[model samples]
Target: MATETASREPRTKTRTTASPTVGAAVVKRTRTVAVRLTDAEEAAWIAAALVDGHRQLGAWVRERAVAGYLGKVRPKAGGGGLSPEDAAEVAALRQEMTKWGNNLNQVAKAINSGQVPPVMAEHLEKGWLNRCGQALARMADRLDALDDQG
Candidate 1:
């Protein structure tokens, strides 16, 4: 009768332990940072956070802090010095400059190899100089436009 009762009793299952990698992945953020602000400063920060569509001031501040740090450490293309459109324009200008440089090199090679007459070389030099001046003026205008936007 005792053996029969023991057989009828339910067996307990043992719990399995989590792997180290899984346990590490489940760890929660426990670090804290504190900041002190005056009443007016706190109020201003709260308003700014609200304006930025953040429900919590802490979240807003954290996002901004991380963004600012990332901007300083790994800035966007054009080194965060120029807006996207301006950066693209600068890239295009660089490409154009490279083409101009190649063209100048070809002209120089032609002149040095006596493949071009003196008059034609002079004409090519003058044409490239004019083109360079025009490019410079256009770049200056674009810079002025960017300044105005800023």
Candidate 2:
């Protein structure tokens, strides 16, 4: 009887990701795509990116491109960005503060000119100035909180 030998091939190692989330895989963006934009076009994109609170234009562009390619809407930037309600509140607070600043400046100018503004006198008599101070303090607290979040 003759003996026969079995041939075997070397096995290669395979790698896989052990991600906890099912059906979710992290992909590295390694490819670079150069885009040419005019000054106006770049400005427009930068403005849009700022509105979306994106500090990096390249990251914003990549997100927009991928969203467009997938036919999905680009969501707002999450980290360090305010929600819609908070943004609205901040805008209102800014407008209110502007008005208060203008009133204070007018009062100061009147006082320096050796004349008391009637509105200032009225606010003082009605104790409205105290109320305004309280409001400003509250606004300052809220703004401080918002700044911390950002």
Candidate 3:
């Protein structure tokens, strides 16, 4: 009778194997990059990252590195690579811009400090406008040169 009752009981099934397709769509990150930094360098990088409001130092470094690379490799507007001559011209233009900026700052300071009479201020304003016009002309010439090269 015990054997009959045991035979009448239901059998239980067990699953011991995992499905092979369970994680098919998931990608594993296997690549890694390693860098050695001095204590001061690490601190400086961490400080900069924090100042930029980045939660992760590695992310900050990666973003900066990618940006720098893109800036160097990106082509100019006229579809030509940046040659040495182009680089020199750019540097000269930057210097000119800095000089003009300083001149404008001085003019503003003089005007604000009441160091110049109204008539003199008018003359200074005209001169500043002329300087700006000249800078624009120079930039136009450079653009023409670039057009010819392209």
Candidate 4:
């Protein structure tokens, strides 16, 4: 024998999403991917995705998901029209991203472990995430604008 609970509610079917004016619309999904992760790899990816205040992950994942979507990457050696100032700025952005990644991881651990006290890590984490997101978006746009494919 089986038992069921009844609710006074109407059921509805889902409809499709609308397309954008300028570009084609994409359907959102909830499909799952299967991967075999060892302890080390799991830990590493978590660190990577959550690092630096959970800001860079979006950009990082986007870049990986769509090749060349962020536009031209740095020029190779012997590449011409490469300005030193631009190169230096890009390098600095990378460094900034790294710093943010580390800070994010620290904050995540604090929140997870319920330890690392004397520190309300969430506030700083949120601030850094906002800063990193702005910086990342700008840098990606700049890189795209340069069209610096080498």
Candidate 5:
């Protein structure tokens, strides 16, 4: 006597392999998620990444996603990769330098056009030039300090 056989489908298993560690933590990125974004959505993501001081869009996206999932708040990104306090100080120095440069230019123009005496122009140029140089020095120092800390 012969018996009847039942038909069965083959089953395949999905793999979740661990990837290499990124940064200071040993993160095993075992799964991949695919997302489809419209042009406007991609542009918005890029802008947000730039605003967050992130050079890598993927990293920024992952960070935002994880933060959102975990309900965490991150810092702002308005200082060209600098802290808020450092950025503010740098901005103030930049404004001061700009003002000094303008003053020096005006002094030079006055001297050239014979609107001011030679002695007065000399004094004004020297003062403004000194202020500009000081501001530049401060900016450099601040950047150097930031680099050191970073």
Candidate 6:
């Protein structure tokens, strides 16, 4: 005898395939983090991000912060980049200082060895002591300026 089969309703079965179409790591790689925002300023911040195409906001803020910090710093004696003459003067001063340092070291060794005549030793000591005094005076002047600032 032939049996009559009922019409099957539309099946809602989900695919349970063993292999996924995409890798798990790639699927979950990018995550959006939510941050609390002030109602008033949120629009402005988002507008900035949109205007800049969401690129380099951190760098822009960092540059602005650095500029503000530099603005607060005290200006050097001549300020900004040095002029050619100023650089040349600094180079000359460095050479002079190096020569003085070598002279001072040799004199120190001579004095320490106790072989040089006492007269020569006294004169060298006197000259070096004067230079040291001048250097200390300049340091004191710088410190005084700091004190004045405070």
In TM-score terms, which candidate is top? 2
Which residue pairs clash in candidate 3?
A: none
Tens-place lDDT digits, model 1, residues 10-53: 33542233211354464333334557776455555655554454
Tens digit per residue, CA lDDT, model 6, 20-78: 24754322222222345563344444334323333243433434445588864323332
Best by lDDT: 2
Q: Give the per-residue lDDT of model 4 (tens digit) for 2-22.
A: 233444543343224521134
Local distance difference test scores for all models:
0.57, 0.64, 0.56, 0.50, 0.62, 0.46
User: Candidate 5 on 62-123: residue-level lDDT in tens?
Assistant: 78988999987567554456554554454455456577778777877887887997776667
> What TM-score against the true fold does each predicted structure earn?
0.35, 0.46, 0.36, 0.37, 0.37, 0.33
Screening candidate 4 with a backbone cut-off below 3 angstroms (N, C-alpha, C), the clashing residue pairs are 52-100, 52-101, 53-104
Error of 3 at 105 (Å): 2.2
Colliding residue pairs in candidate 5: none
Among all windows of 10 consecutive residues in model 4, the one with the lowest summed lDDT is: 49-58
The backbone clash count of each candidate, in order, is 0, 0, 0, 3, 0, 0
Clashes in predicted model 2: 0
Clashing pairs for predicted structure model 6, backbone only: none
Tens-digit lDDT string for candidate 2 (1-150): 223333353224322342124466754433445676764565556656645677567767767877789976665666537655565556566657777778768877877998887777887689866777887888889978876776
Pick the winner on TM-score between candidates 3 and 5: 5
Off by over 4 Å in 4: 1-78, 116-118, 122-128, 147-150
Model 3: residue 94 alpha-carbon error in angstroms: 1.3
Question: Which wins on lDDT, candidate 1 or candidate 4?
Answer: 1
lDDT value for candidate 6? Answer: 0.46
lDDT of 3 by residue, 1-150 (tens): 111112343335322232123354533323335577764555556545544444366666666777688863322334433454554454455456677778777777877997976876787767856877688678768856854664
